[model samples]
Target: MTRTARPRHYLMCRPTHFEVSYAINPWMDPSKPVDTDLAVAQWERLHALYGELGHRVDLIDPLPGLPDMVYAANGATVVDGKVLGARFRNAERAAEGPAYLDWFRDQGFTTRDPEHVNEGEGDLLLTAGHVLAGRGFRSVTAGHAEAQEFFGRPVVGLELVDPRFYHLDTALSVLDADRDEIMYYPAAFSPGSRAVLARLFPDALLVDEADAEVFGLNAVSDGLHVILPEAATGLAARLRERGFQPIGMDLSELLKGGGSVKCCTLEIRAAA
Candidate 1:
């Protein structure tokens, strides 16, 4: 496939049909349950915000048994025109892949399925030649390696220790690709993980612990855009200072289920 510049399209799952309204995220303790209506409202806000930002959002049909399917982490990605679906490690979330695969096949996507267990769009980040794959919790070491081989690109595994940063998008988000700058939270990432990140993003900025708790370390869309939790006003202001247009929305419901901006959305294809 010849390389042609493609626009980066960000995708977010609408919570209207999400399963697991109980706020039962695999990473979060089962003791803390979620309220259904609040969850719905939170997802609504997020959807509205993303829609206003001009990103193409393809909402999948929510599987009856998987409430977290709205997270869309198990979906497929379109890289160099080939569609790849995940073989997930989380038993409860595995169902998401087939649903997305059905959609991709219907859309005429040339699909590739990984033999090893791999998290979907959540664990992979593509930057030209480098593909940073996340390990620990929802994703595994073997999955990361399989991802590299599957994409036929060099993959760097970022080790995440804390359950809070179960996905790379949770504690590590790319801020600027040209400068190799990222916004990250050290507490959520392991020492070795941070070292790996430093190498990828030598001028990375650390988001405060308090901000990280509020999902402030998530990705900065396109170079000039940022999507953040509405609760983190201070951090939003800081982003504005950096010449970024901050778009804030409520993701409290997703927080109850241990997900935020990056988890709820997957930028499947983007313009370099």
Candidate 2:
């Protein structure tokens, strides 16, 4: 009999104000909103979908000032049975860690906190042999070493150059398990990071900045399922042709904060 692994559960935050950051290039049209009511409806729809897909979904009250909190993946990490709520490097997002801790405690989760001031979850990437922690952007190299010591797993440090792709999820994601194939954006990864990635998965698919911008090279979930934006239709079609189920959503509001599907959804627990 084939064994089916249990699906991971997560918490998703709703956006309080759907406005884009003016300093960032991609701006959501402030003049026209599809419908504030529809936005609420879509959030509920996603909530329902995750539940239907056999995932435990927790809904958190939206924080007014932190609009990007909906991308929960950036704020937390899960290893084994423990959930680590990250301490965001951005002052605006630091509040999210305590909120996550409270949420997890209420849900009966045993959680861990980063040892240092730097604890953004997006910096940590789970690989077969070890976890690759991006040193630049929101998470620090010290935090990576701490994670290694705590988990007893090797940790590789990486430096991120672009602020837009501040987190590793913005430019890279693990796909196949056995082969360890990764989909990564070339520009966002450092030379050392690339070298480590190549050694782990020699045939890793290198995606471009444009594709990553459109969320085309983010995460591939459950081997066959992928969570990406509607903008990646071509990539979606290719994935479908390869017998993969591509789930697309219109994350227009998330673009304001430079995050997407992978950013907002934190998988707290997954079976090995």
Candidate 3:
């Protein structure tokens, strides 16, 4: 299929207060210091790149002491003018859940406060008229059910086995929603989930461990163009071979916080 670039709207938060104050995930280490300035620079460059591509970019105010707020993708899952609020499992990021809900509500979105634990886009990804939900690490299976009911969409619950790829976005990325094209790391998912992926996306690109470690699957794609981590050389080469214009950006500073390009981006889609 011939691919064309389309303008997308994304929401992001500046890493003004981004830091590893506490260890909620395996990648975070409070013992080691993070370069906040470098993180901001990288984030700004990404923001500019989005603008350069003629994409709409929105921002949310970053509050103090909320270091992980920079990862705006975990805020809420917005679809068809409705938002299913995130129910963070850890207390450290619990406050962020409500903050995002409030923002969505104020923006005229019909918001549903979650009753179960879910990490917004971190665990729930929309593609091919279905929601691929993650569980086992942060989001619960019950949360997947809740999302299914709220979104009025079929939700495929995929269990994450590896702690390194705790979130679904970290393990898989939707390249072409219309074509049901995806890229994923098989080892990150359980045997059953891998089977489900195989059934749903038979032609999905299987990323190797080297690219997966660099968070290559944690990418944002608009069918023809893919923005990914600069270190993911293998993934970049594969994307090119597949006719995707791969744009690499350095988010090494933010990687310390266990987030990359896609981690900092939240796609805003209107109701179908």
Best by lDDT: 3
Residue-by-residue lDDT tens digits, candidate 2, 1-272: 12133466676777655444433223344444344354555556666666766778667777776656676776677777566668876676678788777777777766777767445456777766667677676788777877777667788777777666777777777665434556777678778777877787677666766667787765536565676777877767766665667788776555545666766677665433
**Model 1 spans > 4 angstroms off:** 1-7, 19-33, 270-272
Question: How far off is residue 139 in model 2, in Å?
Answer: 0.8
Query: Candidate 3, residue 119: CA error in Å?
Result: 0.2
Each prediction's number of clashing residue pairs: 6, 2, 1
Candidate 2: worst 10 consecutive residues by lDDT? 20-29
The alpha-carbon deviation from the true structure for residue 88 of candidate 2, after best TM-score superposition, in angstroms, is 1.5
Q: Ten residues in a row with the worst lDDT in model 1? A: 1-10
Better of 1 and 3 by lDDT: 3
lDDT on C-alpha atoms for all candidate structures: 0.68, 0.66, 0.93
lDDT by residue (tens digit), candidate 3, 147-258: 9999899999999999999999999999998788999999999999999999999999999999999999889998889999999999999999998999999999998888
lDDT of 3 at 122: 94
Q: What is the C-alpha RMSD of each candidate to the true structure, in Å?
A: 4.3, 3.5, 0.8
Is 1 or 3 the stronger prediction by TM-score?
A: 3
Every model's TM-score? 0.86, 0.83, 0.98
lDDT of 1 by residue, 106-141 (tens): 767677766666667677776644777777776677
